[model samples]
Target chain A: MTSWIAGVDVGGGGIRVQVRTDDVGLKARDRGPVPRIAGAIDTSRLCGRIGELINSVVESGARPAFERIAVGLTGMPGLVRPAELADQLRLHVKTSSVVVASDSVTTHLGALGGEAGCVVSAGTGAIALGTDHRSTWNRADGWGYLLGDEGGGGWIGTQGIRAALRFHDRRDGGSEALLRKVEHQFGGVSAALAAIYNSPSPIHSAATLAPLVADAAHEDDPVARAIWVEAGRLLAESAFAAARGLPQTYSWGGRLFDAGELLLGPFRDEVLKRSPDAEIRPPQGQAADGALLLAARGIPAGAIAEPYVHEFA
Target chain B: MTSWIAGVDVGGGGIRVQVRTDDVGLKARDRGPVPRIAGAIDTSRLCGRIGELINSVVESGARPAFERIAVGLTGMPGLVRPAELADQLRLHVKTSSVVVASDSVTTHLGALGGEAGCVVSAGTGAIALGTDHRSTWNRADGWGYLLGDEGGGGWIGTQGIRAALRFHDRRDGGSEALLRKVEHQFGGVSAALAAIYNSPSPIHSAATLAPLVADAAHEDDPVARAIWVEAGRLLAESAFAAARGLPQTYSWGGRLFDAGELLLGPFRDEVLKRSPDAEIRPPQGQAADGALLLAARGIPAGAIAEPYVHEFA
Candidate 1:
């Protein structure tokens, strides 16, 4: 029987799991986000959640034990104890070999398929990583919503909402269409303001408005279109910054890119503006796939170091 | 015996009370911010805190009763119940006449002395109010930190911190001096990020760093100076927007203006850019002084309406 391998993606939105053998692969998702306690990853609950997702996807009669497992998560850098996560995953998934790393690393691997290039991921937040899975690892952005994440969904949505508020206040740079959309979406500007400021996860709440911006942009709203254009340029800057020493090949992943040409057209223009020789390609897969590949093949020699990626056997 | 009148400024930083009766004005202050519960003013606690401050300043043997009392408070618009606050305060300070109004209204009164001009108040947040204290009341900004409050202390501080983070990440728009100052101020970048993000009042925590940006600007850091320049411009824009239908006379209040020429230089330029005939002047006093003036004279005829200002006797 082919050895089974599992990969987990723990992100701001939720948890997703994939269990695969050479012959078949199964996927499952849970809406619960990776638990955070006092600004750090809740490793125990995260491992348990990953195990449950993986086990549910595998055959009921078959042993839930996996030969290898890899987990990629948000808020992992400097805050997560990867070894502890690996240890806990071993207890939960019955895997002898495991790898735990930041989602940025996995995103890079999945986008470039372990090649030495750059990948920018823009979901609720944005981050770029350039690595050969070895000694050359460069990162840009991902400083959280308050400090960075310039071109992410949170950034785009915030601009949209601010424009709406400007319209409500009769200030310059107001967007009437965006104002109507926001008022319709959140009942009223005051209610929207109250809800977002009082929200437990305000960044995510702001990010939920990204689509509203995109919709307005598609309708030819100048202010909304300008927001996306700027977002695309900023995201491109992030990708290029990470790709500094690496080959100029770049790819991207994340739901924010689902805005399609509205984001990509400007993103491509900015990338080409930076390097005429740059190669831009669609992502090969996603973070979970990268985790699965790492579990199956193990981290390449010198791909990463401690405090970034941890391994257990 | 002369009757006493009191003015209270309830702000994000704390509370201050000034009691006067023509001959003497005794001032008392409390570091406790106006209590907020569920995003609305905690009127009962606010009145009690004001009472405690007012009573502490009056002679123990003398009656604390005032002929009139006026309170200018943050978060008062659409949230505070003037009648309820009046009832509560009567039990505490024995006030017969009370006027409750939004801090924006009082800031304008304090800056322009109730003239028909615009006043921009820029502390942790920023707001512009243009009113004749009769029929026309024009407001701009003050949408809070997330959606608006542009050119405010929070905005300037956030830009300063963002520039520092960019330097840390070796990204474009980085400010080396600001980065050094921030790390020095907060022990390290990581600690600062954690503290600011996890703070109960993130906006105020961010605004606390505004002085650091000002310091860097004084040291001739281009990025820091640009931040101040932009802040000044945005503030002027708010003032102009509010002054649309009123006289082109403008003044400003709040601690943010303490940045001196670093802020005022550009602020004046922008105001003149909009109207070459504009008048810019120094504020006469603080918010508490405005409250005192209002208490002595009462809100002017057609100056304001319900939801903006409430009067009880």
Candidate 2:
């Protein structure tokens, strides 16, 4: 019988599950829209949904029975109440061992290939987390949607929309490009306003404006360009805050990391200006892979070694 | 028949009606929260309620029939649709004269004592508005809570609470003062979180944290003090943006003005570092008074020879 492990990455928009077995390697994978529970999903619901996802992956018969499971959650409202969550999951799925941690921890684990470094996640939300080899963990920002969470998709989108609206309100003909883009994207002020107030996830809808802002940056809209540049600066600031007490090497991961040069170029420029010796490394795998790696360690008291691998095969 | 005018200061929390009749001088005044149209008084309902408040002031038998009525609203969402709002009000009350402008406009009118200067309003929201003697209006910030509105009560409160939460999450053992203050004022983190999310108006609830932050600043909490000091600097930046095209003689109003030395001392010190010649003065009257002054002349055409008065009374 092949020993198997499962990892789940639950986020604001969706949930991803990955299953890994020694012989079959990583085979079963699935994703689904996040379940809406009145307001937002509480910890119990979150853990339950994650457990169900893990069961589905295990029942797919692509991998052997899971001996261990790890769940990484991004964009969670608060810090993981690990013990309570673990207890809740025990009722649903029977795994030999489980490890629950912030999606950030997994992101860092995957991004640095489970090495000692820092990872800055700038997606719908933004957070910076760092770990030294000696088990010291530091984090900055990631205060959720209501407060801070600066230098992320939401921030960029907000800045873009605001600049567009201000341009519309000015009537003095300053930001023609921005106004035109807003009109094109959101139809009119009324529609835009309604969409902003009435949307299920206004932040996500607003975040869609980020790419438009990036396009505008290319077209020389000073306000839009400034927003992107500032996002880079802020992301760098968040990274620096996390990197303060860490070693020279660090890594970054997130959906925004895919932007490669456009985002990281400015981010690197800004980070180097503040912290001269910082080194940036690419993530080895997705957050789910890191979680699976953690689960594979099987009730280890110390930090798991070889937590993430670049290639599943 | 004496020509009577009503000045209404409508805010998010409630509406304040100040009726000025030429015969009775300042006459009877009353205020109440807006009635719910469906189940809740949203922005539109609040605005409609403002119109109702103005009409109540006019028909409450406190003064003789008025030739014209002027109203000043403090918390208008935006100024693009004031004409539509005017038409709506015209449907309710049979008043020949009605002028609709931003609350910042009225506050500036009052701060300058009907003279032409600048007023920076830092209440639940923040905006800096300036008028040259030549009738050109310049504005800085005040893009609403979603956009900018920086240096206001909402901004300060939000930042202060975020800092407190950061201190709480750090577990670094310091920030005991901040933790105690948060527990005392907002209950625990759960209660504070609920109040922030579940309150009728999160902005106002956030604003409630300002005084506590002020106390913390007084107590020399470095983080708390930094919040206020940074708020002051941002307010000054907003002022500087408006003051760029105008002369040095400028006045300020809004609730933050009442804090006076406590708020402006640090604000002015920082502002003067950039602009040495700025002459700051107190507001002549409340925003409602400024609205009355404007409405007396006619909504669109009212032009005071001396818009700003040096003395309060």
What lDDT score is found at residue A210 in candidate 2? 77
Candidate 1 lDDT over A1-313, as tens digits, reads 5788888888766888888887889999889866878878888888888888888887787765678788888776767888888887766678768888788877777888878898999998899887767787788888888778999999998999989978877888999999999999989988888778779878789999999999999999999999999999999988888888888999998889999999999999999999789999999999888887777877766555555577887
What is the C-alpha lDDT profile of model 2 across A139-244, one tens digit per residue?
7777666666777888887777777765654522135677688788778865775677557667777777778878887888777767777788777777777776
**Tens digit of per-residue lDDT, candidate 1, span B112-155:** 88788999999999999888887788888898787789999999
Going through the candidates in order, what is chain B's TM-score?
Answer: 0.95, 0.82
TM-score of each: 0.96, 0.77
Residue B9, candidate 1: how far off, in angstroms?
Answer: 0.3
- Candidate 1: list runs displaced more than 4 Å: none
lDDT of 2 by residue, B242-274 (tens): 766677656677775455566788788876777
Best by TM-score: 1
Docking class of 2: incorrect
